[model samples]
Target: MRVLRYLVLAGLVATAGTAVAAPVTYKLDPGHTMVLFSWNHFGFSNPTANLGQVDGTLVYDEKDPSKATVEATLPLSGLDTFVPKLDEHLKSSDFFDAAKYPNVTFKSTKVTPAGKGKLKVTGDLTVHGVTKPVTLDVTLNKVGPHPMMKAQTIGFDATATIKRSDFGVGAYVPNVSDEIKIRITTEAHDASAEKK
Candidate 1:
């Protein structure tokens, strides 16, 4: 009976080992993902610009949040500031120099759980041909099935602040408010769900 008990215990251990969940990869929905940035204009007002056509992938492990990772790309070609003349100037050689450095990117290096449904993501942000480390405060808004798309989906809202000078985009430091505030909202869906 002792040998039988030992055999059962070993089998249970093997079963438990195999039961560990693997990470799930979700594709960011370009239509729903948006990045907005605002900066002070000579202390008069804050002007905001929108960046669209965002694409990326997020890997998440529910069992171990630390194993999560994020990689995203933002195209400057989609930048819109509402003012046509200002938009032309921003995309010119004065500010972002979008013609030379066409894309901004972020790749997370570490992910730490801050609290329930919240995370602190540390990553390298590349803009205007310069790279700098930035930390984003992220909230996991929801993770569930999308009723309309009929797929598993996840949503996140994140915020961060960075100095334009750090990324070589400082055209007017004090006047344009050296610091820029950024907000990002994204919805991702499991690409594998489409096969079902």
Candidate 2:
């Protein structure tokens, strides 16, 4: 009985010694992150718009990918389509109503491995005062120290599609193409490294 008790205690000690690594938090590098979206314009051609100055955080653990989390914000007031007038129109009440709802955001609920350095991130996307669930297909571009910045960084490319009407931005709907394709290229610097 003493020998059995000793064995159980030893097993418990061994298990306690094995600690799971905590996820590392990274802050989005605004200078290296971009959010671009495209939609069919009257079926003539696809036009694209860009949202500048994105900010976010990503908590990830490569050893335990399921622990990954993401939160991002995009200011709709910074929307640009190259054409100044069209840019202004997009922010007007007819479209995004940027004055009323200035920012769009996403907070991940689940992170699932999708094979080959890819992840399927399911999250809540809030836009124009509406919140909807959306999934982004993400591929890790690279992870390491940046040569120029000398900071630990991780890069990823993600894509998703959403219907504008679903977010109450349906002014043109069928005419302007309700479906919008979004592509994001992001680089994040380790929060701890940023202090140095």
Candidate 3:
């Protein structure tokens, strides 16, 4: 009977360990997450646009970071180029055609640990009704309790270069530059944590 009791206790301990090592779900904080992209214009200068109001969730496993996954959506309505006419023109059919495809989205298919606090995230990016595979080099900035929000938060900075022509947003191609550089910064709060 004593031997059986010891075995049961061992099993319970193992189960508890597994539970503590499981993945965690974190919801992106829209107010703290933003996407920025820049493109070269006729070899003269580079123009940037900021996109906000991102909605997404991230499933992260600190014990096994390779299993992490991320999905995000950015509405075109939130895009700002700091120029009203430029923003309107970009949303028009000449560019993104926001009336038809109003949002840009990305869903990770695989995540690989690159180095200390770094990951290579490969995902499908949908833009202007076209979907393409893109890889983002991501660096984990920090993961801890937020000072103001009073919740556990994880932050990351990611960057990627994509060709606009490949996504069917190829207006003025070579003139406006087909390649676009994208940078994303996000802070996600643990969904299971209570905010005080």
Tell me the tens digit of each residue's lDDT in model 1 across 109-137: 99999999999999999999999999999
Question: Which residue runs does candidate 3 get wrong by more than 4 Å?
Answer: 1-20, 194-196
Q: Which regions of candidate 1 are displaced past 4 Å? A: 1-21, 194-196
Model 2 spans > 4 angstroms off: 1-22
- In candidate 2, how many Å is residue 126 off? 0.6
lDDT (tens digit, per residue) of candidate 3 on 1-196:
9999999999999997897577878999888887999999999999999988898899998889999999999999999999999999999999999999999999999999999999999999999999999999999998777998787789999999999999998989899999999998999998877443
**Residue-level lDDT tens digits of model 2 in 13-130:** 8775553244679999889888999999888999999998888899988678878999999998678899999999999999888999999999999999999899999999999999
Better of 2 and 3 by lDDT: 3
Clashes in model 1: which pairs? none
Q: Report clashes for each candidate as comma-separated counts.
A: 0, 0, 0
